[model samples]
Target chain A: MRRYLRIWRIFFTHSLIQDLEYRLNWWLNAFNTLLFLGSSALVLWVVFTQADAIGGWTFDQALTLLGVYLLIEGVTVVFLVPNLNRVPQYVRKGELDYLLLKPIAARFIVSTRYASVWWVPQLGLALAVILVGMARQGTLTAGHLGLLALMLVAAIGTLYAVWFALTTTAFWFVKVDNVSELFTAFFAAGRFPVSAYPGWVRALLTFVVPVAFLTTVPAEAAAGTLTWGWALAAVGVAALLLALSQALWRYALANYTSASS
Target chain B: MRWRPRASLGDVIRVDGLRKVYRVHEKEAGLRGSIRAFVDRRYRDVVAVDDVTFGVAPGEVVGFLGPNGAGKTTTLKVLSGLLHPSGGTVRVAGFEPRRREGAFLRGITLVMGQKQQLSWDLAAVDSFLVNQAVYEIPDAVYRERLGELTEMLSLDGLLRKQVRKLSLGERMKCELAAALLHRPDVLFLDEPTIGLDVTMQQQVRRFVADYNARHGATVVLTSHYMADVTALARRILVIDHGRLVFDGDLSALVEARAPEKRLRLSLSERVDRADLAALGRVHAAEGLEIELGVPRADVARVAAAALARLPVVDVAIEDVPVEDIVADLFAQGRAARAADAVRAAHEAGAAAGGRG
Candidate 1:
């Protein structure tokens, strides 16, 4: 575990240096990330102002959920999304060949290779919003905070599995870049609680996309509304998904043609 | 581990009837196949490797030679475990390469000229350090290897500079250093010196040779450049059209295929074109200087007799180059391939016509 962390740090530092090369692009992208955050906050503010509560919580509760949603989105953008985007390029250019030859796990390398420094500020801002919302609500329990921390870690792990499985389709389908984009579009619905929608819509969000676990379920734990059974279920589901995705990645790697012409 | 059977160098690397076949999606140029592909895809089997078998004793430097699409890289990929073989067996350092266990991957390295492993935007030193951690090499060993490679490749100031800012040769040197940080026991170099100046090319060749000699490491290299092979490889493996055509000593292949001798002349005056043509084919000519090809049997007599009669300024006899020999082999291979293609087509057409 320590060795893996060391490798991850090295990889992160390497990606940081690479990203810093285009200083102008970084600044422009940083501003763009800010715009995305501003728009998200504005939309949430307007939605809460029009209603006393969204689904079953007060304005502060909805704000906290929105804050967690932004934080999750920002985390994915900073690390997972960019690395997933590289998967198909690796296939097309045969760069995956080198990655596979390494002693470490190929999935680990591909999942964390590229880091987007522009998303850092947005993540910080999202965390700040969560903190501010918590302070305003007061009456925060230690157990609730602990559960939120566990759910946060579990959310990141589950997201890794989801991204890995989607990107590994590059092994079979040469042009799946648009498919990944469509997946992100579908996942955008997770910003709201599943209970806010009708029964069939809630079922679709739960079974088809599983976006509820990414946002509402984690936010529920932070808001002291999560059941212990659901918390165990979330951890169990994340472990299963992580295992399944890694198995799929290995299988796809075995079937890889490596851009032969 | 110490109580296990101690295997010798002879069994270091062995391959038996290895094969790889790729299912490639076939699409026509027009919009019709594209539309059809969206609904129903068509695929054909491309046999990238067909029963290629060979072995390298430990510490032997072997050159894998082939044309662009002749499966040299595919074979290396299989041996390195980047791609699973469709059939047959491969063992390197007594481990299955496809398993890609830490022990197996630690024993070898593959360098491809077209793809870079270095962090393109960072200083070369940072990339090397990253490699050091990943390969888990001790700091002292990393420093020593880096120092030696930097000195041998003349990468003094290039290490501190960003990889993007370096020239092609400079970047290639940094890449070599990164690849060599752990000092792998088996090296697979694919076009390592593809694009470099003459001096840089020689430097790389020397470095490879010295590294192999010092560590007694097994090395297999694939390249289109015959100069790289001739200077470093004693044994050559030639593959064509996804099959092994020849695998033997370099000198033997040259002697058998390139038997003709070259006669170079710096004449005192311009000789008649007809006269030059009569002796042998004029390989090259410029002003009073000329290079001619002559059969081995007639080379000595032709040179001696020509010098006696004409005002010969300078005359020399040398063997034909290895590049020409490989070219001759490739031409012969292509003709044979064309013939096979025609026969296959004819048989297919006949069968279809008969069925109709």
Candidate 2:
């Protein structure tokens, strides 16, 4: 585990250097990220101006959900999204062999090997939104804040596990070029609370796809509506999903007819 | 393919009847099958590796010689634990490759020419640092190996340059350094010198030879370039169409497959095609030059006859190239396969007739 962390640090530093190598690209990508967040914020502002609340949550409460959504999106785009996009190409081109031959766990190597540092700045914008939402809510107890932190960690783990499982489909499904696009389209639902969605869609996002664990539950914890039982359930689900994803990864590795082959 | 030697630390790697099958989706050209594939895909099994077996004794250098799609890469992937064999057994440095334990991984390294392991935008030295962490190389050893490899490969100044900015040869040198950071006992190199200029190729070949000599590392190299094999590998394992066709000394392969020497005659005037045919099989003919293959024992007689009868300005005799010999081997494999297909078809026809 110590060795793995060392590898992860190296990977992170390499990624940072790679981004810094091209100053123009670094600035342009950062601007691109802000433009995207600004557009999302504009959409939220326009919707809130029309109505004080969408479904049960007020505008401030909805912004809190958006903040959590940004946090999760930033995490995904920084690590999981880039890695998932790489897996299919590697599987197709057989580039994954190099990672497989390394002295570390293949999952850790593949998932965290390369970082997309461009998306990390979005976390700042997300924190700003979280602060504004907290100010509107007036106060937050220390216990609730602690629970919120735990929820955020569990949510990120669950989201990463879900992405891993989805990307592992490339091993069995060969032609997964469009898988990421489909996943992104569905994951966009996490920008709003599950309560705002219809029953069936909510159930699908909460249970089948688990986007609620990625955004809504964390936002709920921030809104002081989070229950300990559900938070435990989220942690349990994340652990189970991570275990299942690892099993799937091994199965995929066993069947991976390397591109060279 | 058999593994009677059993488990022993002396033998770093052992392979026993390893097989790999690829279930590739099959689709026809034209509009009909393309549309049908979208509705329902069809697949067929392709035997990429058909019972390949070889072992690397610790500190030995071996070469895998094969044309494209001959399963050399497949066999390497299986040995490195990148791909699971459809059947058979393999052990790499006392560990099952499929398990991919840290010990097994630390014991080996694979260098692929077509794909790069370095971070493209980062400096080559940074890539080495990353490798250091992954391989858990102590700083002292890492520095020593890095210095040695950098000097040997002439990579002193290039290490600080970004990988994308470096030349292909320089990048390959950095790649080699990164691979060797762990001092892996086993090295699998697939076309390590592909696309390099002749001088760079020689440089890499020298580095590999010296590395193997100094470290006593077992190396398995695969390359289309005969020069790479001739320069580095004493023993060559030739594969054709996913099967081990020949395994012996490089010289032995040439001697057995191509016993005859080629003689080229540059005449002042165009030689008659018939005359050349009468002397020896005409390998090639141009305006004023003719190349022929003659038995080694009869080379003197053939050269003497050609000189006396023809307006030969210059004559030279040289051994057949290794590429030509391997090509001939592939051609022969194809012919044999065609013959088997015909024989099988005849048997099937006869059975159908009997049933009718």
Best by TM-score: 1
Report how far residue B237 has shifted in candidate 1, in Å. 1.4
Model 1 achieves a DockQ score of 0.55
For model 1 chain B, the run of ten residues with the poorest summed lDDT: B1-10
Fnat per model, in the order shown: 0.64, 0.81
Determine which window of 10 residues in candidate 1 chain A has minimal summed lDDT.
Answer: A252-261
- The segments of candidate 1 whose C-alpha lies over 4 angstroms from its true place after superposition are A18-50, A257-261, B1-11, B268-290, B338-356
DockQ of each: 0.55, 0.57
Residue A17 in candidate 2, Cα distance off native in Å: 2.5
Kindly list the per-residue Cα lDDT of model 2 for residues B1-356, writing each as its tens digit. Answer: 22223334567778778888887777889899899887899988899889877777888788888889999888888888877778988888788887788888888899999989887778888878878887778899898888888888888789888799989988898898888888888999999999999999999999999999998999999999989988999878889889988877778888888889999999998767999998898998988878999999999999999999999999999999999998899899999999999999999999999999
Please give, for residues B1-356, the per-residue lDDT of candidate 1 as tens digits: 01112223476778888888888788877898799887888989999889887888899898989899899989988888877788988899889887889998988999988889887778999878767877888888888888888887789989999889998878887888888888899999999999888988888899899889989989999999998998999988888888877787888887778668999999999878878888888999899988999988999888987888767999999999888888888889999989999999999999999999
Every prediction's TM-score for the first chain?
0.91, 0.91
Error of 2 at B51 (Å): 3.1
Residue B2 local lDDT, model 2: 21
List the lowest-lDDT window of 10 residues for candidate 2 chain B: B1-10
- Model 2 whole-model lDDT (C-alpha atoms): 0.84
lDDT of 1 by residue, A35-148 (tens): 876787788788878888878876676667777888888888888888898898988888887888888887777877778876677787777777766666773678777888
- Estimate TM-scores for all models: 0.90, 0.88
